[model samples]
Each structure stands twice: as C-alpha cells, then as structure tokens.
Target: MYKYNNFYKKNFIFKIIENDIRNKKYNIICTRFPPEPNGYLHIGHIKSICLNFSIAKFYKGIFFLRIDDTNPSTENIKYIKSIKKDLIWLGFKWDKNIKYSSNYFDLIYKYAIELIKKNLAYVDELNIKDIKNYRGTLLIPGKNSPYRNRSIEENLELFKKMRLGRFPEGKVSLRAKIDMQSKVIVMRDPVLYRIKFQEHHQTGKKWCIYPTYDFSHCIADAIEGITHSLCTLEFQDNRILYDWILNNISIKHHPKQYEFSKLKIEYGITSKRNINILIKNKIVSGWDDPRLLTISGLRRKGYTASSLKDFCYRIGITKQNNIIEISSLESCIRLELNKIAPRAMAVLRPLKIIIDNFPSNKKIKLLIPNHPNNKNMGYKNIYFTKEIYIDILDFSEIEKKNYKRLILGGKVRLRYSFIIKAKKIIKNKNGNITCIHCIYYKDTLGIKIDKKKRIIKGIIHWISCSYSKPALFYLYNNLFIKKNINNIDNILSFLNKKSLLIYNGFIEKNLLQLNNNNQHFQFEREGYFFFDKKYSNKNKIIFNRIISLKKKNN
Candidate 1:
C-alpha cells in the first residue's frame, strides 16, 4: 500500500486518496489516462493527464496510458500516434507498455457471457430510436423493453449471433438488466454491447460485436487493477452504471471512479465537432493551427511543455465547474518565457530612419544581452549602421498625451546604442511619412544623458537596415470573440476575423543562426515568438507570435 502524504492536501482528490491509503485500502495505488483516439488531445486533456500522472508519481504507484478505442468508427492510427507523442512530449512515462481496450475484447466478451449466465444481462432487438424512447428522461422513469425478460439461454444464443455477424448493424444490442425505474437514467439497463459491421483498427474483422465505452472501460480498469479511476464531471451520472458493471462482473479488482471538473477556457472551444466545423470552413489552417488550443496547435504555436504543466498546476484540481479566463493560461507561458526566451529586435511595418550625421561607411558592433535579467545567458552582437529600421507603431508624426516613443523633432534612446533626435521627415505623394532623418549623439552609447537638457525619456528597439534579414510574422489571437462561446450557435458567425494577422518584418541578421533550433524569442518591444519550422525554409523565415507582452483588454 502507498504511504499517506500531505504534499498535495490542497487538492480534494488527493485528500480522498490520502484517506484511502491511511485506511490501508489497497496494495498499491494505480491510475490511468484513457483517451479515446478520435481526435487530437486538447488543453482540457492536459489537466487530467497532469492530475493522474502526478497522483501515481507522488505515491510511487503505477500510471498507465490506455487507449479507449472501443468505437472504431472515428478512431484512427494517426490519432493514437499523436496521443502517445503528446504524452511523451509532456514528460510522462507510462508504466509498462501502452494498453488498448481492443486487446481485451475476448476477455470482455467472456465477462459479458458470465453476466448473461447470471441473468444480469439480456440482448434486445429494439432499434436505436425505440431504445432511446424507452430510456426516458430525468423527470420520467424508463419502461423495460419487451425483450428484457428473455431467458439467459436465449440471451446467450442471440449474443452469440451478434458476435457471428448474424445481424446487421443496430439490429440488436446487449444491455445489462438493471433497474428500469431508477432515477439515474444511465442505470436503466444501459447498452453493454452493439453490433457494428465495421472493421476495427486493432482487431480487424475478427469480430463484428463491439462493447460500449461504459461497458469496456470499467472492465478494462478492473482487468488492469486501476486503483482510482479519474474522469471529468460530465461522467458523474455514469458513475452509478460504472459501478454496476464492475460489481456484477466477476472481477478481482473493482476500482472506484472519481470525478473532477474538466478544464474550460473562456473564448475557446474544446469540442471536436466545433473545431472540425472551423477546419471544414477553412477558418483555420488545420488541427495544428496556432489559434487552436489543441496540444499540437499549442506546440506549433511555441507553447512549451513545462509551461503547460505549470498552467495545470496553477489551475489545480477542483469539483466546481467554472470557465477559466484564457489570460490565466497565457500568463503562465508569459512568466515562463520571460526568464528563458532570448531577447531580439524585430521591426514589423518598418519605418526607415536615416542617421544623416553618422558616418555613411561606419558599421559599429554593439553587445546586447540575450536576456536582461539572466546574466549567464551572455550577450549577442548587433550592428549599428547609418540607416536603421524601427517599428512604424513606435514613431508618430505628432505626439499624443503621455506617448513614450519617437516623434518628429523629439529625442529617444536607441536600444543598447546611442540617443537619436528625429530632425526631419520625408513624405510620399499621399502625404504619408515614408522615412525620418535622424542624428545619433556619438558619446551617448550606453551613457545616461541629462534628461533636463536632452528630454530623451523613451527607449525604442531598432535593427540596422544593412544587417537585418527579412522575415514573416504570424500574429495569433483568440479564435472566438465571444466570452460565452458555449452559447454560440454558429461558430463562424462569431469568429474573430482578425484572429491571425500576417506581417512582413525584419529581425537582427544574427537570428538566422538560431533558425531551425526551435528557439523562442522575445522581440524586444514585440511579443514572444517561435521559429515556425513548418512554414520556414532556407529561402524565407517565419515566426508565430505566441503571445503579446501583456494581455490586451477585451
């Protein structure tokens, strides 16, 4: 048995497990994360993954990665592979080899036969619609099917026929003969197995009968001796049926089920159906679209595994269902990247600045710290040339109240270099300022100038036009504009049209050496960004902005 520990007493689930261990409930604690291989795992799954894995690891128990592939209609090998990859990327090592529910099909079938022999199960010939009509709602009790009273021997024969492909799909189903008048609607003789004339991904066409998730899940847990079965609160109603199946079946280990609230973020959609609609309509590129919250999407967007785990820890485990502000998650990544991400300067919507007073042929190298606070990270060399590029947003022809940036005839400090005064402006035929003429103070490099005389209170990041490389930046925002996305009938209608904005930018030429290294960068005044391996190549560089410097007020 695992020893009691108060390390995670803040979490209610841990407290329950601690009590169970204190009372000597079992020989060892075991937990499993069983994901149905229908779609790529999302941010919501990260919560359960961290909880289960942390529980087992804390108690020195066993953790299992199980695939609940009972339904083959939507399951795919690619999804299974992606699930495993996501787990591995999250730094979790499942005990023993990965388990699949399909591997226990024969044994689960035998258990079903045992229930039939014990008069606890019966095969029904009712169609899908009639079964639903008989299984009434929460306010009304369901009535038993006419076939509910079939003898055990007849049930065995019909169930055998179901296995032999004797009936077409949905013609017959095997349901447990439980209380029909029970308040828990799922306990009203829930279907245990159904006939599907579909090919299985793992078992192939060896069997036509497939067990329902409610039927196979508990049996699989009992078979593997899972000590605590953790699931989301949506399955709270199914707990009664879960225990019913385990208690009636002849299993040595009957694991208890525990429910916790699933993670729901505001302005985000976790439903696979809704995400598919977004993809089908081409609102997003694919499942790995950076705007999405899918694990792959987040990964592609440059969210680190450690940052996600930290986010899970910050949210913690709870029974109360609530929508978490998306900023809570973004804050975790922002805090993490602030310490590790290298600082670089990039100019999106570049405004040309010609330092007329500086020597035209002079190119001075300046040492810029990779991280402001992290001295061990060392420094990087950036060139200061006669002409430089600054973000257009950083310069204004006329100054506004409390604006801390460059203006015509105003002075500002060029980051890590010298102070510059905007002397003149060059405009185009449309009266739009295309460039600015400036002069740099030769003695002000890394020097504190007198604010009383210079009035240079603002510092702006800039990259040398002669030494900068052209790049593309993908700025991502919330996929949906509505805070209450759950009530959205048409996701496309409420879609944030400007969720993804592309910009042609210029970064320090030295950044080219870090390309394809999967490096994360904080672009000085710009937000955090990751080198996009999928879109970047030898000819062109691309980066996806992970998040802005701070959350914008909606």
Candidate 2:
C-alpha cells in the first residue's frame, strides 16, 4: 500500500498526465503494453507490464495487450502464447482479445501509401548496404538517395510491385522524406517499410512487404484509441518519429508517447539477443531455467506472484537507469515466503544416527507447528524412531571450542523431540563416518534441562530413516558469475559453473500431500523449497530450492 506513494510522488508520467488533463489533451486515459512476439518475456518486461496496467487501473482507463508483430521473420505463436501466460500469471487483465500489428497490416499499408501520395514518403531503390553508407556518421550529415527525386507515379508503382513480390529482398525500402541533417539520428529519414520475401506467420503469403516498427506502432496506438503510450526510455528519441507519423496521418486521435527508465539487474542479462545466445549455446536448460531471471524461470523457481509485484512496486519508476542488486529481489521472496510457506523436515545431506538406548521396534509421534509465528496454520505429526538421519554438516568427530552440535561426547536436542547425548562414532574403511550412536534421555521430552549439568545448546532438524521419503533436490545460484555483462564478446565464459547443484536426499512423508497443491515449504533450518512441476513424476519427486536462509550483506 505504501509503495504506491512512490509512483505518485516523483513520477514524471503521472505528472505529464496531470498537465495533459489540465490542458485538455484528451478526455479519457488509455494505455497499451505492446510487446514484440519474437521472444519470451523477461524480468525487465515485468516492470513495464505492471506500470502500464497499474496506470490504467488507477485512472480507470482502458489497457490493451497488443502484439507488435511487425517482423514476421522472427515472430511466432509460441512466443505470443508465452507472453499472454506470463501476463495472466502476474494477475493483470486486458480489456479484450489480444491485438496484433498484423491485424492492422492493411490499414498500415494504406497509411504508408498516404505518406507517399503527399511526397512525405518514397520508395528507394538503394540496396541495404548502400543505404547505411549514405546514412552518414554522427559527425557528418547523411546524403540523400539518388532515387529521392523519383516521380510520385514511379514511386507508387514501385511500392505496388514490392507488395506483389516482384522485387528481390534487400533491393529497395520505403523511407520517410525527413531532414537528413537532423541532430537526432532516428529522424534522418527512417525506413517506413521493407521488402521481405519470406512468408509471415500470421498473414502467410498474402503479402510480401511489411511495415517497419517505426511506421506501424504509433498508428496502431491511434487506431486503438490509446491515450498514453508508455514504453522504455531508449525510445525517447523515437518519440519524434512516433509523433511525426501520427500527426502526418489524417487520424483524429493522436496518443502521446512517454518513456521511463528500463529495468536492469546485477549479474543477469535481460537482452533478448544475449538470452537467445545462452539458449542456443546450451549454457542454460531453457528460457525457464530457475537460474534465469525470466518470469517463467522465476515461477519455476517457486517465486510467488505477489513477491514479484511487490518488488516492482518498491523499486518504483524513475527516469534514470539503475542496476538493482539481485539480493533485493531475493529478500522480497524470502519475506513473503516466511509468512506463507509451511514448515517441513528435509535432510539435504543425510548422516545416519542410531538411538541406541531406545527400543529398535518402538515409534512415537510428535506434533510440530506448521509455522512458528502463525498458530492458525496448526501442526503436523512427525515420528520419533530408533534410526534417524541428520545433516552431515551438523556433526563433528572431534570436539572443538564453542561447537554447538553433535561432537563426540557432547549432548544436543533433537528439534520437537528430546535431548540426546552422543555415546560412540562408527567409522568404515578409509576413515569415513558411517553412523552415529547416541542415547536419548526419556524425561527430557518437552522439558528444559538443568543449565549446569546439561551443557546442551544445539538443536538440529532430522528425519526418521524409516518414515522419510527419498527426493531429489536442485540448488540454484546466479547464472552469471560477474555482476555486469558489459563485454559481450566473451560473455559465455562468465557463465557460473555452480549455477545448479543437485543432491539426492530425504523429505518428510507428510510432504507428499503437497503433490499438486502449489505450496512452498521451509525445510526447518535448511532453506525454502517447492515441488518442481516441470521435472516431477509419480515415481520420483524433484524439488527446487527457492532460497536459502542466508541473508545477503548490504
């Protein structure tokens, strides 16, 4: 609730809206999140999704999910489906069925023709390489194309031929006839349309010519009655081109474009190109690899939707770029999970322990609280048995100063059970610990021991060897070792080798009830975990470690 204050306090977009309303720029507020359906949505897209949708919701305006599928060469239905799925998972709703740039291809072509009829646009015969050469550098003004003076009749005929696939790809392109010497490079007669002989995914072979993004986006916004077009700051300069195209057209409604800073995170790359490289190179399992920062990956990694939304809200929106520390995101997940995730016992690395004094055939049940701070969650029963397993790291063969765990000849408490004292240590060939022999004090159950005589300060979690279920655990770390990926030439070398660590361990039998419950659980002192839906089956259970209890230093 307090996070919304940040958006209203210093937000330039909201201020712009307020000024526009005062100046009677528009009667109603409307916004759109137009994504290119070429790749899956990344974590950076989450902020844009929240900003655009929340702005519309706060103002009671219409929000649209428009697919900017201008380049049919790379667009596909899979990416489109993934985008919609990710948006729904984030809990945002659109006003109607998804909109696509392809849906307005016919109208867009007419608009391009309109620009040409007014001599504001022309079909150039210069090849792709020659056009770039003439575009000039930052220090020089771009020279006009030799075909710039083509007759309006000739240009219209050439454009028609391009649509009919009579011209080869890369032979010619439609360009806006703007001042080539303008300070902004984007205003230097940007390309309006290109000839792509390849078949389109949406329109198929209906047409070979496609309108460029610069030509399609703004008009599509106007056709949808969008009032405020919110996008990343990189498009700030393109605002001129956006307005130029819209104002030049005969459209009655002209939507204003507003730009905000893009989301960047430390140790992760959000660029779709780089992510695609990682996928192609097989550095990651897929787009949904938990080590990745993509939304699907985060979902697979057991992050709750509320936590992601909270993270976006807390970070707020700003005009300057900032690299958010990954730990800040993790903290949000941990905070949310601490309140909702149920408690369970899991042994990531098991060490056999035998309660020698207890009867081998006897068993007792202890009721453990599901959550320490929330009583309404109630409790679950765990069995106490002669044979149990503790984490190997919790025991030491030789006693050391201030050691709090099961050092030989030392006493410790079994969580929710009784005090136990180590009597002997069993070792196998090559001097490796195979089992620990201990004796439990029968009266110590649910009672505090005398401080002077007990000398027991350690408490650890364990599972009954007989009742625990075998499980596979996946521990994940950041995908990249470096905090920045500025040098992309050798970026693959920076992939974190320890990004994923696997272990075969045991979990409490009671956890089987969570098979398809979509629940997160804390393994007592170990860490938070969830059933891995993508890799789990009836015969075997695989879990992904959500986050460890370790706190990151500020």
| Candidate 2 lDDT over residue span 1-554, tens digit each | 23545665667788888888899887778888899988888888888888887778877888999999888888888999999999999998999889988899999999999999999998998887888888888888888988898888888999999888888998889999998888888888899999887778788888788898989999999999999888898899999999999989888888888888988888888877888898899988888988888889999999987888888887888889878988889889999888888888999899999999999989999988888999988788899999999999889988777667888888889999988888888999989999999999999899976767747958888999998999999999888889987446677889899989998899988686743374688888878997886688877888899899875331
- How well does each candidate superpose onto the true structure, as a TM-score? 0.95, 0.95
Q: Write the per-residue lDDT of candidate 1 for residues 181-235, one digit (tens) a residue.
A: 9999988999999988888889999988889999999999999999999999989
Instruction: Identify the runs in model 2 with alpha carbons over 4 angstroms from their true place.
Output: 1-6, 400-402, 449-454, 514-518, 550-554
Query: Whole-model lDDT for model 1 versus the true structure?
Result: 0.89
Q: Please give the TM-score that candidate 2 achieves against the real structure.
A: 0.95
Question: Highest lDDT among the candidates is held by which one?
Answer: 1
Clashes of each: 0, 0
